[model samples]
Target: MAYISYLDLPKHWGLERGDRVLLTSDIMQLMFTTMRNGERFDRDAFLDAILGVIGEEGTLLIPTFNWDFCHGVAFDYHKTPCKTGALGGFALSRPDFRRTQHPLYSFAVAGKDQQLLCDMQNVSSFGVDSPFGYLEKNHGKNVIIGIHYTDCFTFVHHCEEVCGVDTYRFSKTFTGQYIDAEGQESTRSYSMLVRSYELYEATDLTLIGEKMERAGVAHVIVLNEIPYRIVDLTAAAPVICDDIKNNSSRGICKHKLQ
Candidate 1:
């Protein structure tokens, strides 16, 4: 009775072509439940679907937020289960491969153990360790198939204005492993920062568009609005729509085009 099985996603997302895509369980649940009222897609099933769509070379980009994984005492730890938030399930479950920390931006990526192809971070006045950073790394390679979301990229914008930090810093902790400076077995942290997300929509899109251009990503698909089939990010074109009758006052139900 999972949402993925219940909803006709293969048809809706135009998966017939078998394109590569990046999706989170949170986004899958939201898209399925909002589009249909049946069983939801479980975590395993959703992951399977993404793998099936992307194939071997196709990459599935996911964000592992530093706030969720960090146990350090410097920041406020929410301690909520990974699946509770928007991208919580994917962020929590994936393996920690690469991490970067700074005063403003901080995040990590689930490693190859979790089957991630590309992972990177950025540091800015705003939190730069973001999904967008992931997008930038693989930009112009047509390396990205899809950028799915449960919640829009809103936190990145909020963190910069509120946190007032310069670099977003992150690290992966070792439980049992140890290493020494003289090429001996030891444990340490790996960190870096690529860029930041300022509070400018146009600037943000411009960067996103340039990355998408490099990656050969022709479409930026979103599930919420239904006015246009596709949008050209570079042109800043508006999605044109036809006027429809509002019959809520009457008993006549109408099916509107999305």
Candidate 2:
């Protein structure tokens, strides 16, 4: 029960240089964590510590997902705000971080692969062409802060979509006005695998993480008394997609489907 300094993060979190990390966090859960080496926590300092450890060779992506575009609302790539959390807004506020282009599921990206991530123009929100797919193929990790990943692993939908899970989800498209970096506007469309009400209530991705930890692909780590899960998307996607394909429970849902 001790306050941990930012410099000690690598030892506890296993963050290394040249790594690619996609993070989703609940920053409110960190409000009480002002004690950093007997001084108040500086958000920028925390980010610097992580980015410094990862170095310019690594990449950090913070989810800035805004669903307004999914509902036919216009999405401004430069102006629309983050609806996910404060961490995303913080990333958005940083000059070093650039936002991705997918309206419904964009991220604020920094470090080495920033341009590549910002350049992504995926047709489907969770398909192989999306950032989720990049994380899966590029040896990226899904990092969770202050919350259990089961509650926020949007990547699960990516697996279901790519695996063509027909029982519990269906592809749906939304069209809206999109404003790009050049200030040009155009009507564009995006697809997402919407959950089916006929199938099951909710997905249970606990098993996916369990399988990974058991196989030693990844593990949950704690830093400064906060639970953080940094699991390889490459490793976890297989477990999820396979279950989506053959699990009688219909892609690891809360209840079995008849």
Candidate 3:
């Protein structure tokens, strides 16, 4: 059984009124029934559940994985159903934004201060053509959160090895544009990747924590059992990985709880 309850998560995670919360894919699946017997995708219900948590001015963070882009081409992970990518569903549902080209990096928003930082690839074919692109345009003060996996950020490292440029020299960009159902166009851009490191040593946790703090995010709760170090955030960073050999399960890091 899982340790957290999606319905009761706000209270369990100690979320106060007006606090923003992020949900991972595992949490999303556990909370909403988008798939019934593995068939229909309940788009409305999924969106409603998310909106329920994000009342107003509240943010939700989600990781967008680009498995398809990395498979065989970049980091080959020998596994079936390996060609999947990640998208911020909340961002997709918004009104002012729309994803343009390169599904992985092309989220567009209409607001002046809206921020989305994606570090995954393979988003080229993710139904980001219609209303998805709409939300990409109006991202103003509302926060549409995005995150990258520990391994994906290594692109910066790859650039160093291949181009001889420092990780600091590399920058990722995401662009979005508008199009009618029949197809017309307009565009915008944002930075995606920041830094890189080797897989074993690569982790954006510190940066993630810093961003959360800057965003005024209060409590961060982990559902997995993977052990990790909490660098700059005040919340308890728990290990929720199920693999016993994983660092969290083995308590490899003293900062992590077993």
Candidate 4:
């Protein structure tokens, strides 16, 4: 396998200037095909490639989610660590990037919206005030790398929450000790729309992703044997909301909550 430079990311990812993108990716694959000075994976080059294309106008959001807060553990703003993937850790290591405050669902944001995103008072993990909501307000793009949208796409929970789908899921609160960036500690409570697993089966989004693909909002591409799906959340949100509104059972989950 040959190497592709950072210059090739924009064309392959279908990025444009001033675009706000949410990246759910597996960056470890870079080790297989990319190397910086023959030492390790060219992760920095990967970020540089995306940033170069997005320019000063575009904003990049990488999920820095750590779920220890839900397990009654204290969340350290600076060191709780990202359980999602290598991309979040990489972004957190950069000086220009700033992380949002939601301990379970925070994001490492960069570019034009860095301050705007970091400034959010993350009171909820998936509410109107959450980073997910702000991104939806801006109609951001959901970019999946080395994975399929069905396998991920937590953004749909935002749709389900706003659209009101308590039939299958309901809002739940998790309170824990939160350690701030300034090293202050306090007890805090956050909300997430968790599944009613006892009533219905686990949420499956395979069908929903297919629906978006058919609606022409979700697109799939392959580069260097890695699969990528880019969903225009702005265009696809309506499709999901409509499905949930008309047929909640058919929208995301397989079984109807009883």
Candidate 5:
């Protein structure tokens, strides 16, 4: 097998030097193809490939969200593990990664803008002060690997919050034990723009992801049988938001169950 190294990343993903990227992935599937027999996947090498392409001036943000916090579980920023998947957990374990304190939706950051993301204080999960908002502000790309958008296109929800598309979501507050950056414990309340279950039917955001791909801001690549998508959130958000606003028939919100 011809191995793809860290040096091959930029060309494959069309990543620019020093570009900041928010990565959402399930490394397991990719590993199935990329890893050789009887050897554990080297997460460090995968991370290095990404970090190498982004270079010193770039930043990498990985979702470390834990929904249990929304249901009254305490969130210790220093110890609470991300339920997202292997890649997320690996990112969290890195000493350089700093996680934001949002109970339901949090992000772990490394590289140039770690402090900026760690300082986010958005009470609302997708509010302007959240990590999603920060990614947009920095003109970052949202890269999804070995998973479909329906599984984790979180940035879309941020755009919905920004557009005030409240037809299918309601604001709710959760109180939990939170540990701040300084390791101080405090009882805190945070808001989440939760979907109204009665109004939702498990819609697939992959269709919207496909739409973005057609529009040129989203790119898809297949390597060793694993699929990867790279989307410019700054460009894709407006298109998605408008689709939500004007086309109720084809809207992301679903009214029927699958």
Candidate 6:
């Protein structure tokens, strides 16, 4: 039986020292491979390895977004679970982690930038103050594990907002009860730049992901049969924004309106 060491993650995942990264992972897929050879995957150990690579100066963020508030259920920052996956929910329980208050697209952050991220309570999910916006402002890296680009490349929405691509999205408000970290409950309204899911067919984004890879802004790697991508938001956003602004069909939206 072979053993896996947390120390090996930096080289295996192409993680750099002092890097700020937003991690999005499919834990089930990662566990299937990493837990093989009579070994088990330790969530805490894995997180520690990631932190070790980034060091004291770096920041780590995990998306703990849930859309329950949009469905009329109250959003309790302490109670609402992340629909995204296991890692995000796990991060939320850590004493050192700080959770943002965006309701629909909140993030749980650890490391030096935790307080800065915690202060970002954007009323709109994709607006300038959202986590997506903050990531671009900080020139952070996006690490995606065992998931397709279409499912996790939320920065595209930030690019859309930067480019003012409002043709595909509209501002919609959801009002509901919200409980803050201190247990203060209040009725509030939050806005979302919702895509016209019913009127438009989903565009395949694999092509753009490939394009970013070729452009050198995104690095693609496959380890133990699970695919991963690391992209620099500072470099990739401009290219993506240009593609969206120039091309009528950038492979992410329906060419014809319904």
Q: Compose the digit string of candidate 3's lDDT tens values, residues 72-167.
A: 222211111112223344445556433333333333222222343222223322222222222223221122112332322222222222223233
lDDT of 5 by residue, 194-214 (tens): 878877666677678778888
RMSD of each: 13.4, 2.0, 12.3, 2.4, 2.4, 2.1
**Model 5 compared with the native: what TM-score?**
0.92
Q: What TM-score would candidate 2 get against the native?
A: 0.92
Instruction: Give per-model TM-scores.
Output: 0.39, 0.92, 0.35, 0.92, 0.92, 0.93
Tens-place lDDT per residue, model 2, 10-114, is: 456777789898878876645566453465666787788778888999999999999998777899988889999888888788899999999989999999988
Model 1 ranges off by over 4 Å: 1-11, 14-20, 24-37, 66-87, 94-134, 137-151, 154-258
Q: How far is 235's C-alpha from truth in model 1 (Å)?
A: 9.7
TM-score of 1: 0.39
Task: Tell me how far the alpha carbon of residue 151 in candidate 4 is from the true structure, in angstroms, after superposition.
Answer: 2.2
lDDT tens digits, residues 41-68, model 6? 8888788888888888889999898999
With candidate 6 superimposed using the best TM-score fit, by how many Å does residue 164's alpha carbon deviate from the native?
1.2
What global local distance difference test value does model 4 have? 0.81
Task: Give the CA lDDT, 0 to 100, for residue 179 in model 4.
Answer: 94
Q: Please report, as a residue range, the 10-residue window in candidate 2 with the lowest summed lDDT.
A: 249-258
Identify the runs in model 2 with alpha carbons over 4 angstroms from their true place: 35-37, 249-251, 255-258
CA lDDT scores, all candidates in order: 0.32, 0.80, 0.32, 0.81, 0.78, 0.81
Pull out the clashing pairs in model 2: none
What lDDT score is found at residue 201 in candidate 5? 61
Greater lDDT among 2 and 6 belongs to: 6
- Lowest summed-lDDT stretch of 10 residues in model 3? 75-84
